[model samples]
Target: MMDMQTQPVRSQSRPVVEHGFVTESMTDTCAIVANLEHCTNTAVALQSHYAQGFLSSRHKHGRGQISYCQSGMMLVMTDEGTIIVPPGHFIWIPPNMYHQAQAQDGMCMLSIYVENGLWPDLPGNSEVFHASDLFECLMQRMIEIEEKGAFSSSTFDAIVTLIRDEIGLASRLDMSMPMPRDRRLARICNAILREPTVLRGKDELARIGNVSHRTMTRLFQTELKMTYSEWCQQALILNALARLAAGDPVTTVAMDLGYVSPSAFSAMFRRRVGCSPKEFAKQY
Candidate 1:
């Protein structure tokens, strides 16, 4: 993880009226974000801290957002799925996409919002990607410039270009679990999310969804583009990430996720995440 400390800068924008969207009631960070939407600048960067359990209610931005999780973990919930943003990772949200963000173990996030059409080739859907060291440095520079109110400076423009190019080159991580659109499959998937540790076979899950096993298999491939088992493993990995980020022991997370042993879980986690759970947890 990027081991850097940053002071949260309060938004200078005036208080916004509560419109059942983003309000002061839903974490101060969300209110600051609400104000940034109207800024005329091509891009705006803000640093905010959120307490554990802090949640930003469903909201949409007029501009695309790149939210870097500097500390703790964040889950960005969208209609399609949940994207896990662990420490040292960031999530890219396309313009006008409604989503909710929840913080785990408290969070310090640096968000950069860019105007629509500013980067015409940016991904249209949400994605989570690891933040490289160089990318982090550029982001830090951008934040510093934003703090100094130097949006029009040549240096600021150069930094913005570099940051955008860095983002374009960053590899997207498989830290997301896409949800199925069918109500029956969605119900089963939600149940699994609620209790990822519970063991169930394809037939059992299909029965729960009131669909035939073959139909359930077809739905998984058609909607999520993965097999049922693959989806389950992904759900387990995501849930394990959240628990592990919150300081849960590897053994405990593995057991909770129904892994027969910690080593088994660690091996699988390493295969998927490129690091052992212990190494990943050390960041937090």
Candidate 2:
């Protein structure tokens, strides 16, 4: 409502890697997010254009955030989990939750912000939602209208309402792998994640973490709430998602992740992602 040029906001972000791994690039948060904190509107949207390797530094919003990945993949980390925002997908971020994102090559993102009191009963936690065709069309319309910055309150409000309902109807993806904070488990996870190809047995991996195999198994169950084998499979699928999103060939990704053959890899990928590797690659 007031002059748009009068607001000043600062955001801090860092390069995010697969599975919520923090990369070398990070920027500190400003004294306060100078932008958009006092806007008169209840709903707002913004589009970000970035090259490869762009990392949104760690920050939290006073309002809930909906990040749509129009192209490329965005690794968004939150306390709940690290969500993979592949093309044609969106992630729901709860208000006041710290989050960060890093995009693959030529990433374009459109985000909608809903002030806390505007919508209630939205998901209290973060989750990746598969974008439906109708939802995408509506979002595109929202982008078009918001870009013009001129619309009746009721018209824009209807779009936001539709978006919220559509998102609720959508299903979540098997994208987040439970992370452990225990030092021993963290070490093991980091080592295996560093090179997904390393098919180390539990005994050997436990040795790397300086813990007994029995101890490691117990820790995985208690800390991550999954068996070691279950956790490893999920980790590989996440890594594969990143590679496939980056446009790697299915065969190459399969081999690099230690799959005996593309067929085997494809079977696992299909089970987890509900699509063949080739289909996932085409989006990016």
Cα TM-score per model:
0.83, 0.83
Off by over 4 Å in 1: 1-34, 146-152, 255-263
Tell me each candidate's RMSD, in Å, in order. 6.2, 8.4
lDDT of 2 by residue, 1-284 (tens): 01212222223654222211112212233322334355446766655665566655678878788878888777776765556677888888888888867665567777777788776777788878888888888777766664465556787778889988898888787677666888888899878767766789889999989999999999999998889888888778767887887667899989988889999999988777777899889886
- Tens digits of per-residue lDDT, candidate 1, 32-121, equal 556767567777766667766666657887888898888889878898887788888889999989998777667778777788989878
- On a 0 to 1 TM-score scale, where does candidate 1 land against the true structure? 0.83
Q: Residue 109's C-alpha lDDT in candidate 2?
A: 74
**Residue 274 CA displacement from its true place in model 2, Å:** 2.8
In candidate 2, the residue pairs with backbone N, CA or C atoms under 3 Å apart (3 or more residues apart, or in different chains) clash, namely: 8-34, 9-34, 9-35, 12-57, 13-56, 13-57, 14-56, 14-57
In model 1, where is the ten-residue run with the lowest total lDDT? 17-26
